[model samples]
Target: MEKDNFDEIIRRSIAIRKKYHELEMTHHGSEWTVEEDALAYLTDAGLVGRDIMSQQLRWPKVGSEAELEHKLGENIWWLIVLAERSGIDIKDAVHNFLDKTETVLK
Candidate 1:
């Protein structure tokens, strides 16, 4: 993806998380704890796996490609939120991981 597009994704992801945080604050008395966020992410991640399995017919077909696409995006959103909550610069972290992994593989 283009740099600009990646930046937009980060921006929008944070904005969406902030909206949820606001709701959590209103209903739960505080925003989600990091552990809670991780659990939620894991739940969605599991759904992604299930969706992929269904698409591949490894399991009973339970969801469509559109559901898989949505879960994938939600996982990305969760990653962004997690990184942000941990005070890590996600873009730089991704770049560094890719660089190191590529060098090792090469």
Candidate 2:
């Protein structure tokens, strides 16, 4: 994707996170801690894993691909939120990971 498209996605993700945070604070009386967010991410990851297994096993009615995509997106959203809470820029973190992976692979 183009840089502009990636940036737009990031902007939208940030907006979504802001809205979620507002609702969470309003209803739950506080922002989620890193640990709480991590648990949510893990839960979604487990769902994704289950979906994958079901697909592999040729289950009669596996979870929809859209469901898996939604869970993965939620995982990414929580990861971004956690990084932001820790004072890290999500874009920079992604780039750093890519750079490190490239170096390690070479």
Candidate 3:
């Protein structure tokens, strides 16, 4: 199996987001919005899934379960983007929260 590396993972995540933009160009080009993206990550990715969710309830899913799971990683990238856009270092924030949780549990 391949080893997991955070830097590489982030790079791959960015690439995945880029592909979303490209696909949107041919499909949802004009209708795409940041709120749509955020909501997609929040609801669709959280519910129907970032992987297999369709553009509509009536349409069939385009991929398999494992492919859908892999795409879910993009949701993490979404939060990372939001944090950066808001001038926060999410890595430090998550570490701080974990440290606080550990202390509370002890």
Best by lDDT: 1
Report the lDDT of model 2 for residue 57: 71
Candidate 3: worst-modelled 10 consecutive residues by lDDT: 48-57
Q: Sort all candidates by TM-score, best to worst.
A: 1, 2, 3
Residue-level lDDT tens digits of model 3 in 1-105: 897686676566657767877888879666356676677668745643434445444446665465556556656788766565456777788899999999999
lDDT against the true structure, per candidate, is: 0.93, 0.78, 0.66
Choose 1 or 3, whichever is better by TM-score.
1
Evaluation by lDDT, superior candidate among 1 and 3: 1
Per-residue CA lDDT of model 1 for 1-106, tens digit only, reads 5555888889999999999999999999999999999999999999999999989988787556889999998999999999999999999999999999999999
Q: For candidate 2, lDDT tens digit of each residue in 1-106?
A: 5555656766777788788879999999997777887788788888878766666775444555768678777887777777877889888999999999999999
* Residue pairs with backbone overlap in model 1: none
Compute the lDDT for candidate 3. Answer: 0.66
The numbered model that scores best in TM-score is 1
Q: TM-scores across all candidates?
A: 0.91, 0.78, 0.56
**lDDT at 78, model 3:** 83
